[model samples]
Target: METGIRDIVLKWTAVVVAATWIIGCGGSATKPSPPPPAFPKAPAKKPSVTSPKKATQRPYKVGRNWYQPIPHAHGFTQKGIASWYGKKFHGRKTSNGEIYNMYAVTAAHKTLPMDTWVRVKNLDNNRSIDVRINDRGPFVRGRIIDLSYSAAKRIDMVGAGTARVEIFALGAAASGEPSSKRPPAFVPVDYNKGNFTFQVGAFKERKNAERLRQALDRRYKNAHISEYDSPDGLFFRVRVGRITDLAQAEAYEQILIEDGFNQAFIVAE
Candidate 1:
């Protein structure tokens, strides 16, 4: 009886071992899962600057000079005397970081891209030439088109400090691409900080500016005094602030003018 029982037990153990081996072989056949797919990245783009866009470039009346606002469009046209600057400022960095060479066909415009190409026509002489804008200002009011000395020579404007002429953008840049603003229009930083301000009196007198600040505070609220050194190295600016509202600011400027702050202006902070 004992011998028969032992044989049965041995057979049952062997069967159990065989079943576990078969299950292990089946698990090996099932492989591991694959990874998920990745998404693609996009291309980068440049920044855009937003300034006032006029339907027609308006004539800017600065002092006695008639400033014509160049419309911020793909092309432009206008009439003015084209002149040039050379020698004294040659090899100097223009307003847009370009070296000034009177020998090159460059122009200075109060408003235009630094590297824009425009076809200038001397209406008096019936002569026309192309130029690139690399600098700013004829600063003498009542003038239009500041040409490089070479460009002026080419268009026969060397003799006359002023002339009658017309300018039209030709949409050609040195890079072999359609014309764009010479120095690509980059955004400027916000030039404002809220604080007590002082009114600038005649720039010549420091004491006068301080006196005005004290007087402004007596008439108004929270008026403090401070002097701002200008980049031009002339004139210390006085300001009256610690106030809000555009209308209030304009009214203050009028008051200062009335009180004989002749050069008094508002500093928007």
Candidate 2:
């Protein structure tokens, strides 16, 4: 006990060292697991493909004495004995490439376009009539307007066979004739010039023109064709619309170009 310190330290050191080693080796280390991957949401839808809401169209209802536009008729000037036509000539062809009817309350005026509307006031009885101008007549000179057979009876001019009257233009009027001419017909500066159509090309075949028409109908709703079968033969021609806005019309020209219509241009409707 007095002289051996090394022997006593070595005996206790082994037990402490062995215990530390056993305690440290008893525990095991664990590795961490990875997280799940995140998924992305789809993109938003665009607006171009959506369909537009349709508009409601209004119906026109009229009774008696309505003069609708008949392109066959135009021009007027007259002073004559107005005689009416009826019964036998009803539904017959008039001079202006249109059918005539006695019941329609129509009249005739020389040099005036067919399908014109005239207000005939009887000079004798002062009676009045609204007649559709379809036929042509009054071969005699010094007579300006001629009445359809029915028009003359309505105004009591048939019995006399002669009446003084006036012709009026309604809706869109032709040149020299108007409701009233306060604003000059010719405006040097065209502030309100409207868009119109033109025929850039023509074809003898209707099928070709129709195919072009279908491709343009959506962009140019007014786009159409006119058929003229001259003494020669049937001819089909493609025509763009009478669109009021020229700039808007230009936009359609681009569409036409994309659709393979090259030479397309604007024309008067």
Leading candidate by TM-score = 1
Instruction: For candidate 2, write residues 121-191 as lDDT tens digits.
Output: 77666778776555565444345566655567677765565777655543223345431221233222232
The reply for model 1, stretches above 4 Å from the true place, is 1-73, 172-269
> What do the candidate models score in CA lDDT, each in turn?
0.50, 0.46
TM-score of each: 0.41, 0.35
Q: Please provide, for model 1 over 1-269, each residue's C-alpha lDDT reduced to its tens digit, 9 standing for 90 to 100.
A: 11121111121111111101011112233776454322112214312222212223223333433333333313357775455565666667666555566666778787664555678898888888777766667664345678877678777877665678988875434343333244333233222222223234334466765665566556555445444444334443444444344344445545544554423343444
lDDT of 2: 0.46
lDDT of 2 at 11: 20
Model 2: lDDT of residue 198 = 47
Worst 10 residues of 1 by lDDT: 14-23
